[model samples]
Target: MEAPPLERKLAAILAADVEGYSRLMNGDEEQTLATLTSHRTIVDALIENAHGQIFGTAGDSVLAEFPSIVHAFNSAVAIQQAMWRANQELPEDRRMNFRIGINVGDVLVKNGDIFGDGVNIAARLEGLADVGGICVSRGVRDHLRDRVDATFEDLGEHSIKNIARPLRVFRVIFDPEGDPAIDLAASPVESPETSSFVEQSLSQDRDSDDEGHRVELAFWESVQEGDDPAEYLLYLERFPNGQFVELANARLESGGTGEHDPGIELAFWETVREAGNSEMLEAYLAKYPQGQFSDLANIMLGELRGS
Candidate 1:
């Protein structure tokens, strides 16, 4: 008998997993399984009805593929709504909620299983989603615009693991009562209260940017004084997204000499290393292929590959 040939398809992939599955299982394994069964039954029925194929399932997660992004988004919303209704009668502790992430991309299908970064990203975005909420990749978000009765909060670009590019993320907010009138083309979501949380995050970005520029300048100065490449990388971490990423990279390549200025380089490298593990790394790299400290970044690339 001949083996089955591999299948390939352009699919809108949806991945969902129970939030706090371990806690639920620890609370009551049997009951947790029961609730999972009930929830999965509803989700499975809805997906099938929407013409989606269940590519795979683990203990508390499901991966499905749909031909249309719209169908995938609608099915996800329906699942959430149904699950919400089902949980209403249950006690708070007994309620099981899920986070969902969807993306539209090409996937490899082999032996009835789907594999690739497309699927991996969906799973990661699902983790980023709020409990009982849906988050989607930019591709899916762009596709749903002006068509769905939903509001989206931009999570900005992310550097997800195992995925080559940075993905723009958006959270889908459903009213449950009904779709609210929302402007899809409006600017990204701002904090409703502009609380300290928002301010702090913004402040950090500004500070980092400023510090990064300073470090880039200092890096050249140090190179003039004969600093070591690895030592300089430490300082660069401070301003990973710093304005001098290009200059720093060029200096590293040319082996410029300077006094060791560790602070800025360290800060910059820390950020770059983190970016390598981010959902936005791919996007960042695309824009900065010959980025600052490109040589040292190899370490991060290795780490990410291992991870």
Candidate 2:
């Protein structure tokens, strides 16, 4: 007699992994492990809050299943945003970026783990995501369209590895222009501030054509002057329904100024040294061969290695 059929169900699968896990590990295995552990706390919390379950995870890869496509997509976005916040306090080279992929498909589940082409596709799509970016399968994109209140860029069809057929993919652009809180309809639960902002914008009168042109000119001038995100944000607050709302939001998401914080770099270097290991010192040297703390890091590394 044939064996009983395997358990299967339609689910939203999310796959994510560190972009440069090996390089990080090579730099400092202990610190990499510690950092990964801390990051997992963030990832796991977001997944749980989204009502998803983590079914499997390796050193750097995570696979989870969600009952709803919207929840899964939202979880991916939340994870990315949270990671970005966490990285803000970290040194540039030590920042950990995650690539996430989401798909809605039939999956085989057993023993608290999931498998099937659905998972395979998600894994493949994760490989395509940019550092700190998310990619989703066609099913996810189709369902998320207007429901998510964000822009989706169609990636067209592509043949991914180990897949029998070509698959259509799309990327969720995390371009929050003025207010990061302007998540639109993407979030299932809206905060009072966001609701108020939406209501105010909808109720406000459209600027006169001439006024709009002047505001547009001013927006462009601000951009030309290299004003920071806060400046663009001020423009958005002043002209909620302005012609340049989209551009302003994009600039805000790009963080206006491209300068790195030297204080953060110094703090990160100090933290690494406090670990008191040759590997940590090596990591510091690797990231900043000629940086402010490089001389001390090099001396410590040499002393620790007796070389």
Candidate 1, residues 1-307, lDDT tens digits: the string is 9888987778999999998899999999867776676567567767875778897788999999988898789888877876776676567998989899998887988887998878888898899999899999888888888998888999998888877778899999886544212211122235577666787779858767656545555554454345467754755676576544554664576574312333333334444444334322333343344433332233235435655
Which residue pairs overlap in candidate 2's backbone?
A: 148-186, 177-249, 178-249
* Number of the top TM-score candidate: 2
TM-score of each: 0.57, 0.57
Best of the candidates, lDDT: 2
lDDT of each: 0.69, 0.72
Q: How accurate is candidate 2 locally (lDDT)?
A: 0.72
Per-residue C-alpha lDDT of model 2 across residues 204-297, encoded as one tens digit per residue: 5534644555555546455536657778878888778754465556556657632243443454454554454555556556545655555445
- Cα RMSD to the true fold for all candidates: 22.3, 19.2
| RMSD of model 1 against the true structure | 22.3
Per-structure clash totals for the candidates: 44, 3
In model 1, what is the error at residue 267, expressed in angstroms? 60
